[model samples]
Target: SFCPDSDLIRPHRPVNPAAASRSHQELHKELQRLSQEGKTELQRALEKRKWEQRMKASRDQEEAKKSTSPLHQELLKRHQRLENVLSSHCYCCFQFLKLRQIKQRQLLSIDI
Candidate 1:
């Protein structure tokens, strides 16, 4: 049917077969390379996650062992004792400083 607006619709250009084939081959190769790279990246990420899980499990196991060990208990006890001693020493030093400050103030008042 001849329509008045028919000239607006342009005719399709005949595609070159050789060029089409080459374009298809290039796209296929690019797709294959991308697929391989994606698979390799996925595999590496999985391996890294697995390694992290294994490390966490091993660390938890070691911590559990240490918590139940006699040596660790002794060390914890010693640390508590040291903390107590240091706190007591700090209290004594504070008291000595207060006494020294009071004596200096009394000496200043006497001179005035």
Candidate 2:
């Protein structure tokens, strides 16, 4: 029977060049995979930075819009006030013309 304590045997070296070539090929494939993974991570980081910049720009535009909202309302209010004043002035002009006509008619009746 084989010895029960023989589990510590050293591994045998390959005798053919084919086995060495296979190991080299495997190592090359692993290096290429790691390089590709690193490139992908760098690409992801770049995209994330672009996304952050776009979000910041959007926030700034929203703030600018909000700041101008009150100014727009104030301009509308001023326009309405000007419209009211013009309407009142037009009405006053009409009343003045009517009074002038009536006064002229009264003078004609007295002279006749």
Candidate 3:
């Protein structure tokens, strides 16, 4: 006959089987809830990244259109031509003013 006191190295067991089962169920439910929350968060992050990529692509397309449009190119060329014409006109005016000043100085010296 084995005495219970003699089994000093016996494995521990739950005193109430129903309570242990309930605790296990609660732990499983909590694990499932956390897994579902993590999955939802991951899905939302992926969606946000996709939306941002689409927006960036749209912006890039618009920029390309603006740069390559025929009207925009023509306007840029006209603006450059106008700038060149104005610069040359200003240079001519400056040269005429300098020549007038030199002639006035020469006449004043002759009269003296």
Return the lDDT, model 3, position 5. Answer: 75
lDDT of model 3 at position 70: 89
Q: In lDDT terms, how accurate is model 3?
A: 0.86
Count of backbone clashes, every candidate in sequence: 0, 0, 0
lDDT assessment of candidate 2: 0.85
In TM-score terms, candidate 1 sits at 0.47
Query: Model 3 residue 65 lDDT?
Result: 75
Q: Which residue pairs in candidate 1 have backbone atoms (N, alpha carbon, C) closer than 3 angstroms, thus clashing? A: none
Model 2, 1-112: lDDT tens digits are: 5575888666687687754698877977876786777665467779899999999999999988777777798998999999999999999999999999999999999999
Could you give me the TM-score of model 2 versus the true structure?
0.40
Candidate 3 residue-wise lDDT, 18-52, digit = tens: 54698887877876786877665467779999999
Positional deviation of residue 58's Cα in model 3 after best superposition, in angstroms: 9.4
The alpha-carbon deviation from the true structure for residue 16 of candidate 1, after best TM-score superposition, in angstroms, is: 44
Sequence-dependent TM-score of model 3: 0.47
